[model samples]
Target: MLTVAHSVPKTPEHEETIHKAQYNVARAYFMGFGAPSSEDDGRRWLDRAAADGTRRGSVKAQTMLAMLFARRDTLDLEKSFHWHSEATGNGSLESQGALGVMYLYGLGVRRDLVAARLCLTQAARRGNIYATGQLALFYYRFRFYQHAVRFGTHLARFEAADVAELARQSECLPGYVRRGLATGCYVLSRCQLLGQGGLAADGERGRLLGGRAAELDAATADRLQRLFVNGPWSCASYPDLGVEV
Candidate 1:
């Protein structure tokens, strides 16, 4: 008696193809790109992709899962943290940034500034602009003036015209990028005004940078002004000033 298998057996050679297909299927279901939106079905396919032995889709699938679980309506911080940690272990840059934020804010794990700085620095070095801004702010918060200025100056390199252009295309950019840019500009401006870092005092440049920060993210600029006085690093010390597009 010959028994037929229901489906083809999975092999290492087929892993990449299967992972890609699974990811596409998940996207279609999740975003209604070609199929009706169904988070449940999307998650199922994503899980399969994430489980691929080759680890090709490990970062992508886990990152998406972490983000999906972090949504307000489906908020599951622990699950989000788990997926982020897994993706980070698999060398996902975005996940590294996310874990930095999680550690910074203690989203699903204990607050740890050292870990947050390490994660943010790793991502920022790889050109994650948002992480660059966050790392600047992190250093500023803890009174590491030199380090903060280093990153802030990197972000404040934008020209006035460039800032205006970014504002024009703001809708196309991610909110995090906008907020991060704003943070960098704001911190650099403050450093210029106070001469806290090793840079020469330049109130004119500080004001210009501050104006640019306001143009990009007025709310954050304003909030930081009110919250500039730094104290010990505690949960209450850092306020999450979220600005949106």
Candidate 2:
């Protein structure tokens, strides 16, 4: 398979075809499918593929390259930004979501809430689970009520594909605790608390989510206190809410 795939690069063909072949071999090498596992070789091939990916911007190659640079274990913000920016421009939902996240937190580029919000909205519409969750948090933080109405339900996706996405990206569960998605969950729960979105205002659900977040990290507990206790979310307004701040 490697031999057959490698031969395509030497044949006279379009750059896209050649790059696609190269990316496959690189993936094989990186994952030890048809060749000895070699990060260096895989990276080399990915670089070549990403360079040639320019015409149409190969989403697979560039997205993988971006992940190589941005994953927690190997965070190379500059290269991540470069590849993500390229693929994002080419309309890769994965890249757009990733680049949007970077923009949201100034990971590689300066924090541009405008660009981040635009990219995230696009990604969320495209069904990027992480993007939906992120937008829920973003909208809630900015008090974008109408906007929150669109994406706030993402928290409820914990049992569905969003969990799978988090697992694949290694960014849900434990990772989200660090990245503040857990907190995002709490905020969405708050939305549930106040029926901010189209939700029917269920404090039981709110406590369920907030309780989950509080169980995960102490910092979130502090935040919960501030928001539920000291903030405008008065339990007195509705005495039925069983949980105290």
Candidate 3:
């Protein structure tokens, strides 16, 4: 039975009904609609006409249910996963990314690198910049150096990848991988500068890239600068590379 009301045409009465419906939906989702302990009760309201027949309603219900389950320390992982997965399947980019995160962390399922990669790749292909950044971090941390290089290359070529992508992913990845990527960029720049690494490594060009990195994340950049100053191989071998806060 379609218990929830459908959206009405523009009119004072219709507007009132819409407002009431919206409130009920929110209440049912957050406050449990007088059914706080029962998933079936919550589902009944969620499955009402408003959610069942409308895209927006469906998305709202799905997100709410997902969050509800996620907040429960003892929540059913399978249910949470299913709700989020359904939301993503319904064209919710946020849900898509969230699902990717779930896969990455193995929240509701077994840890699966390939599945995580697939989810992130799907979101990234859809212009989800966060997903792209996440994928970059994943590759970097996993020692997929070639993949990281390709991702960096793509960002450089497209100009769509912002510095924020690097920053966001940096929060989740190991310090070493972040440092390594910066180092790789520095090395590449040096190659361009002076005609090394299959090209001339240009000091001037290297400085430019290094300077840019420093500007983006000052701490990492400074560490990198010091490392370069000390000599690459020597820095690599040094216990701390003399990097200080």
Question: Best lDDT goes to which candidate?
Answer: 1
User: Clashing residue pairs, candidate 2?
Assistant: none
Give per-residue CA lDDT, model 2, range 1-245, as digits (tens).
34444554443455467677778878988999978999999988888777644754346788788778766577678778888888877666667777777777666678888998898788767656556666776777678855665554554545323444554563223343232445456667777789886678998988887776565445644555576566653323322111111
> Candidate 1 — which pairs collide?
none
Ranking by TM-score: 1, 2, 3
- TM-score of predicted model 1? 0.77
lDDT (Cα atoms) of all candidates against the true structure? 0.73, 0.64, 0.52
Off by over 4 Å in 1: 1-10, 52-54, 158-173, 218-226, 229-245
The candidate that achieves the highest TM-score relative to the unseen native structure: 1
- The TM-scores, one per candidate, come to 0.77, 0.68, 0.46
Write model 3 residue lDDT over 1-245, tens digit each, in one string: 11334555367555445534653655565465554555555455555423432444456466555655665453665666777677677775545655775677667767676887888788767655445545654665555645655554454332213434644543222333344344445434434555542444567866776555444445655654565467443313222211110
Q: Total backbone clashes of model 1? A: 0
- Rate residue 63 of model 2 by lDDT: 78
State which candidate, 1 or 2, has the greater lDDT. 1
